[model samples]
Structures are given as structure tokens and as C-alpha cells.
Target: MKRKEKFENRKTVRKTECRRSRNLGSCPAAEVSKLQKTVNSFAYTLEKAHFLDYVQYASNEKRIFRRAFLTGLLRGFGTAVGVTVLGAVIIYLFQALAKSNLPYIADFISDIIDIIEKTRK
Candidate 1:
């Protein structure tokens, strides 16, 4: 058989199995109670998690903009501080190396340090 016919046969088999497994006409009250319990559980979960408040906050344009601006500002400030600290540590290491016994490497590191200091000045 073709792929479409095989898929339709499988679907029909699944439907037959489902119908045989559940006699819904004879269990209306049980079905309604089960459905009500599921709905209540879902609502209780949403309320506990404050899902509505998050939705409201997400829907407000001004709050979103303010949050984004603060996030960017903090990220930029953090990056600047981190780069400054890293540069200072690297320069300190270079200065230490400049005082070592390796003459050629010391000279190169000292040149770099001097250039950096000049740029700062």
C-alpha cells in the first residue's frame, strides 16, 4: 500500500481502540468530575506561579523598555569594569616580567608597557 493509505489505516485503528476503551455515554458524571478536577488543578497552578502578573508586566511597553535599558546599562558597566581590571592585571604581569633575567623578552615587554603608559598620558 501507499504511505497515505497506511497512515489512514493506522489512524482508523487508533480511533477504534480509543472508542472501545472508553464508554463515555455510560459515565457522564465521572467524565465531568474528571474534567473539572483537571481545570481546577491547572487554575491553581497558574495562580501559584503568578502567571497573570507576568503576562500583565510583559504586555506593558514602558516596563519592558525600562527593564531593557537597566539591563543594558548594567551589562555595559560590568564589561567596562571587567576590562579595566583585566588590563591592569596584564600590565602588572608585564611590568614584573620586564624586571626578569630574560633580556630580549624583558625588553619587548618593557616596550609594550612604555607604549601603554604613553597612550594613557
Candidate 2:
């Protein structure tokens, strides 16, 4: 009966105990301390189970979606612009090389284009 009383009372909140009795000197203090520790640990764990709440605590769905979409669209746009600039540079180089005094340079460029076309096949 005493053990059941003690167990029920153990889970309830109370102040730090310092009571003393025969055959149980300092034992109540230990029991109270252990119960308090368990309570504290449970409270701490309860505070952390809100995973989704923590993630969406300060974020709006529309804002996140807008940022992601704009980022991807801008990335794709920049890549297309970069490829166009690179192709222009290559064409300009080929035109300059064709007008040069070296006669074999044009043949070399044509051969390279042929090789590229063959690879596509």
C-alpha cells in the first residue's frame, strides 16, 4: 500500500523533498529527485515533437514556391543566354580564321564540323 501511494505521488509535481524517516533516511530525496528528472525529461521531449511546426513556423507557402520557381527559371534563362553567347564567339572565331593567310585553317574547321556531324549520327 505504501509502495502504491509512493508510485502515484511520484508522477505528480511537487517541490524538492527533504523529509526524513526511520529506515528511509535521504531515500525520499532520491525518489523525488528522480521523479523530477523524469518530469523534466518528458517536458523537454514534448517541446521537440513539433517538427512540422518548427519548419513552417515563419514561412509562407506562396513565398517559398515563388522563390523556388523564380530561381529555376532564372537559372535556365542564364544558361540559354550563355550558350548563345558562346556560339556567337565560336562563329566569330571561325570567320576570322577563314579570312587569315593560312589556307589550311578553313579546311581544318570544315573537318571539325564534319566530325561533329558524324558524331551526331
Candidate 3:
């Protein structure tokens, strides 16, 4: 019993020593530290992979598809609103410029308007 207990204690100590050497840097400190960092990075990567797996398993494909569809729909709506606002601002700017008493500017505006009308026809 004593011999068996001694062997078991030594085995446990060896396991702990290995872990301690990895974590607390007993020897080959720099290399061990790099390895520990890499192991920690892998741990994080594994956690992320698990999280993604859970997300995939818990959510149906229809849910994911709806999420993607809504995202695209919102994006398209934003683009349309942005273009409308931009066109309104441009028209307001041109109208403001037309109101100014600059003869050359008025002629330029009339020429632009004529070109637009020609395009419409």
C-alpha cells in the first residue's frame, strides 16, 4: 500500500509539474510561453467554433435566410433613401444658384435644363 501510494503521488506530481512547467515557466521559458499563448489562442478558437456550431444547430436555415433577406432589404431601402436625399439636395442647390443675379450662371442653368429636356424627348 505504501509503495502504491508513493507511486500515485509521484504520478500526480509529475502531471502537475508538466502543467506548471507549461503555465509558470520552469525552463525554456520563452518557447514555453509562446506555446502556452498558442494553446490559449486555440482554446479561444475552439470556443468560437462551438458557439458557431450552437448557432447553426439552434437556428433553422429559414431563420438564417430571413435574417439575410431582411439585411439585404434594409440595405436597398437605405440606398434608395440616400439617392433621393442627394437628388433633392442637388435640385435645391441648383434652384438657389438660379435665384442669384448672375447672368452667366442663369445662361448656364438654362443650357443644362435644355439638355435635360432634350434627353427626356
Top candidate by TM-score:
1
Per-residue CA lDDT of model 3 for 49-121, tens digit only, reads 8977877766798887888899999999999999999976876777677678579997787677667668879
Supply candidate 3's per-residue lDDT for 5.
Answer: 100
Given candidate 1, what's the lDDT at residue 103? 69
Full-model lDDT for every candidate: 0.88, 0.72, 0.78
Looking at model 2, the pairs that clash are: none
Ranking by TM-score: 1, 3, 2
TM values, all candidates: 0.68, 0.42, 0.51
C-alpha RMSD for every candidate: 7.7, 11.5, 10.9
Which lDDT tens digits does candidate 2 get at residues 19-119? Answer: 33334454556676786799999878867887567568547888788888999999999999999999879867876775674778887876666676687
In candidate 2, which residue ranges exceed 4 Å CA deviation? 1-58, 110-121
Stretches of candidate 1 above 4 Å error? 1-27
Best by lDDT: 1
Give the range of the ten consecutive residues with the poorest summed lDDT in model 2: 13-22
- For residue 28, give model 1's deviation from the true position in Å: 2.3
